[model samples]
Target: MRPQLRLLCDSSFRGPQRSRDVASILREVDELQAKEIVLVAQDLASYGKDRPDELGAGSIVDLVRQVSAKVPRTRLLYLYPSDLSDALIEAILDSGVPYFDLSLQHVSKPHLRRMRRWGDGERFLRRIADIRARAAQATFRSNFIVGYPGETEDDHDQLLSFVGEASLDWCGFFEYSPEEGTYALGLPDQVPVGLMHERIAELREMQDAITAAKRDELIDQTLEVLVDEPGIARSHHEAPQIDGIIRVPLTLPTGSFASVQIVDAQGPDLVAQGADSAS
Candidate 1:
């Protein structure tokens, strides 16, 4: 009824010095009466992998199991270090949280390397395949930055190809803005401002078509939606604010869950109704 709770998973939330007390955090969740949660692993796999013996695959597996057993309704906001280990992928699938919001900056490998990001477009597609094989209805979402320094025709084409191939259900493409003293500003072959706009426009058009097609596939499917506000509900596929929502006729209590039959998908948002009744 109240939507979800975004509880910090640990004290050093942004970086490596982890401190997560599962039971204590669950108590806070109960105090808040939150039915859903989002674990913000800003870049867990990256640092966690550095010392496998101490924070290895085993620890990740155990962590997933702990959270799944304790706070079963939580969703992970990210799975970073783009090339996910098999253990992490299996842990995620087993965790029952089917939504993924990857920080995949760009698809072009050269472009990605330039941006100081990990993973490439092809590897990401393979990861998607692996995830979808187990969780067919998984919602894949990601954000991309377009027109980085030194971006060329080939790089743009590579990203456009990824937009079509990634099968992302929801995505956002942002135009690159030069931040003062950022390393990106020092790179050569800076794209012209007008050309930068052109690249963003292309990515947008490509993703719109892909997102629309994917949403259309959800018609008539029964999904569990949490009523966050009056006449507004969100399924597992939908996140807060930035993502799409479901419009419902039922005046269900905010912060409660309901079984909804997806009636329509207009653009990114959806319209839903009670499974057994009309809207």
Candidate 2:
């Protein structure tokens, strides 16, 4: 069984079929005894013609509690999955879920318009910053697409700056992959593979620096790091895996806690010393 699993609400559209569907999913998750789950109500936002039932107040609270209590380590991740506002986000986090995942393609509004993903980089980053300010320990992640057709060098630069500001824990940089039946597929002058790879590399480098700085900001701070065995030292920005894991570097007799010092920085893992004779 995967340590992290997503319990996604198949539909977030406002319809009789979706309203109570999420609650039912929870029941099944409990049956399976799933402890850690990332619950997402995908496409919660308005998708063209239909405005699905917005993840309402009471409903979101109920769902957050259901998953949190049932699974101690459970976290709820909000996706472009719906039309939720800052109020709804605050309510949801207040309700229990502290992890927020926003889908952001590019910082360039023009690029976003081309792709048809609503919202600009500024607005989205503000929301994420707000969320982190509200909940410091909250996990923030986002995905961006590079090399979209008609993307200029300026567009890529803007994205790099935006990533620096966002300080996202997890940032995914994707080269534009055209899928059949989508508007992007019909677009002309698609980006070349070599250029796309270059852009991806640039964006990744910027993100790497931002992540390192953010992780360094957490130096010497106590965190209830989740343990992943067979781990090694990396950097403050990195954990065990690419996605990251909380590393406690002492050989524990059993599962236990140790005080660690942030000694170095790697991609996303932390190099720390733990469990000395002295505290």
Can you write out model 1's per-residue Cα lDDT over 93-202, one digit (the tens) per residue?
A: 77656787788888888888888887888888988887888788888888888888988899999988888888798888888888776788788888898998998998
Q: What Cα-based lDDT does every candidate model obtain?
A: 0.73, 0.60
Go through the candidates in order and give the C-alpha RMSD of each one to the true structure.
3.5, 5.4
lDDT of 2 by residue, 93-115 (tens): 65334666666667788888887
TM-scores of all candidate predictions against the true structure: 0.85, 0.75
Clashing pairs in 1: 1-254, 1-255, 1-256, 2-254, 2-255
Error of 1 at 156 (Å): 0.6
Clashes of each: 5, 19
